[model samples]
Target: MNSTGKESRHVNIHIASPVEEVYSYASDPANLPEWALGLGGSIENVDGQWVAESSSMGRVVVTFSPENDLGVLDHDVTLPSGETVHNPVRVIADGAGSDVVFTLRRRPGMSDSDFRRDADMVAADLARLKALTEPGQGPR
Candidate 1:
């Protein structure tokens, strides 16, 4: 939740893959561009800070949670306007596969349509992740 105290919308997708495989791929900030198209088209490390060339917001710095054994993929995106948004994401073991969840927060003063658009974007990203992680689907 931000300072406005609004609850975030939860978007999730289940992939037919091992938790380790999903976590290993999604937890890496470098691979975000491949799946998280809403954030940016591409990402790179600049001066030790992760940066992405976002078509929506131009070049911006992105920071992800430290690499850990846990399936935490939370990240903070800093826009060029100096505002930061916290994105909470996680991949959990689900039987023989994995369940990936992402919390989509509505920015303060965002319109209803914009909020819906954000949710749609998250759904698409998760679908992309699912495709990229499924067996025999993603790059080998």
Candidate 2:
């Protein structure tokens, strides 16, 4: 935890793809289910809002940042209880490839095991992203 009493972990992965390509792929909500399994197995747009019906936290709404060249894929997930969790994600250029990072924050009153679980989930999602974006692995 930092001096502000906020506990966070930066879970990231290196993808063997250009930053632009990775950002384009990761920024689209339609492609989320293909890699972001931690969010859900499927997602659909409902009246301009992305809704994931089978997410781990049950049905939830996801709001992504506006499209930009900064590789910012930040999104807010509104839980069933109406609480919104802001997830900070980024795809940065790393030579010929890109480095995708997800900052997982520990919620208030959360247990140690829960924080670890969230970190593991984020790590797995990044790995999936790497698999899907890397050359000769899966679809571009």
lDDT of model 1, residue 118 = 85
lDDT of 2 by residue, 1-140 (tens): 23342888999999989999999989989999998988999999999899997646999999999999999999999999998999999999999999998988877777788788889988998988988889998888
Clashing pairs in 1: none
In terms of lDDT, model 1 sits at 0.88
Error of 1 at 79 (Å): 0.6
**How far is 137's C-alpha from truth in model 1 (Å)?**
2.6
Deviation (Å) of 89 in candidate 2: 0.5
Best by lDDT: 2
The superposed Cα distance between candidate 2 and the true structure at residue 12, in angstroms, equals 0.6
lDDT of 1 by residue, 1-140 (tens): 24463857999999989899999998887788899999899998888999999887788889989887778999999999999999999898999999998988888877777788889989999999988999987773
Off by over 4 Å in 2: 1-5
Q: Whole-model Cα lDDT per candidate? A: 0.88, 0.90
The TM-score that candidate 2 achieves is 0.94
